[model samples]
Target: MTDYVAKALEVDIDDAVRRVREISEQEAMNQAISVVGAGPAPGGAEWEAEQGTDTPAARQTAWQLVRLRIELATGIDPFGTVLGLRRMGTTWATIAAAAGVSRQAAHDRWGKQVLGVLDAYGTGELGGPVADDEADLRRGMAR
Candidate 1:
């Protein structure tokens, strides 16, 4: 929502949403500055995405810190789908053909995880626990 607005308007995300929604002009400006640091990323490259709001200082958000965290926290499990396909007797070559990747590349990306997941869950279902990467992210965010 906010992301789409930010990209569409070519303005800071806070300005695209929070700034326009504020009751007072000063509050909006302050909030915008606090996150965006007067100027940087389309929406405050310094913003502490983990915090979401009310960050004490700006930090480099390059390397896609916010997008990476958000994606890890919330999204479909392509790996899980791949695992299911493999369990269903789908060949790496077939999966790779659909995914537009080489067989070895697909295997290299998901083979280890798929092999461990069936045993780890002891289930052949489509979905179960979050992936290891998401689990690690949740653990980090817990602190």
Candidate 2:
């Protein structure tokens, strides 16, 4: 997509991704609880009412689902980090180094999104001021 279009939709994309991740996380937790009753709380919190059939296979399936959810959620932060780094003028090489990938790989993965963020900033379409701490991170990455 053109940088302008990407920029225009950047916020919407972020919001949509976040919403989906949130839903996935909640669904994973719910499925896990359904399988194993929250697996015995440690802080004296009672488990919620059970929902799914409590069989060994069902429990295993729920566990797998929760694991997959965790993996998917974990993968999203790198996308954000890539955008943040690109926003800060960090070179693709540096970002790739941190990610343990070739520069082309990094760009292939996140370059468009990063470009969108840059476009947003240029057009004054970014929704809010970046946090101070994030700026510090940018500085650190610069060096």
Candidate 3:
């Protein structure tokens, strides 16, 4: 990808990470508070006696949330990759091929957004990860 596309990706990824962390922290706090407020189950003194506490359940829920956060963070990358392909002069057809969609579908989905970034790139406005040239971007993509 060109510097513009790389920079845009970096910003987007950073924002995604930040949003995930913030939401996860808030969710964790809510879960913790709810767990603390939860008393022994109704008419289950025997079960409570055996289980002791519900900390394990709360911890398990927290672990699930953590995994969800990771998945959301990683899932954002393909958007960047698609934008980068456009910046590198890849045809809409090729992008659509990689995306398992039709050329018109690709354009209908991402053309305007990609065009905006490309315009910014040409104007040297959306400064970002610097690449020497298209060849550098190709190599980076290969890896």
**CA lDDT, candidate 2, residue 22:** 76
How does each model score on lDDT? Answer: 0.48, 0.53, 0.53
What's the lDDT of the predicted structure labeled candidate 1?
A: 0.48
Q: What is the lDDT of residue 68 in candidate 2?
A: 38
Residue lDDT tens for model 2, 1-143? 46996687664577787799777656655654665554544344332333333543344434544443343455634454455545444566666665667766766677657657756556744444322233443555468
lDDT by residue for model 1 over 42-141, one digit each (tens)? 4455543435552332232211222222223444235644665555455666556645677667667776687677666656442544233333433544
Candidate 2, run of 10 with poorest lDDT? 128-137
Q: Model 3 — TM-score against the truth?
A: 0.34
Better of 1 and 3 by TM-score: 3
Clashing pairs in 3: 7-128
Candidate 3 accuracy as lDDT:
0.53
Model 1 lowest lDDT segment of ten: 60-69
TM per candidate: 0.32, 0.34, 0.34
User: For candidate 3, lDDT tens digit of each residue in 1-143?
Assistant: 36997777666477787898667655544554464454446568654664757664544434433333332344533444456555544566656665567766766677657657766656744344322234433454468
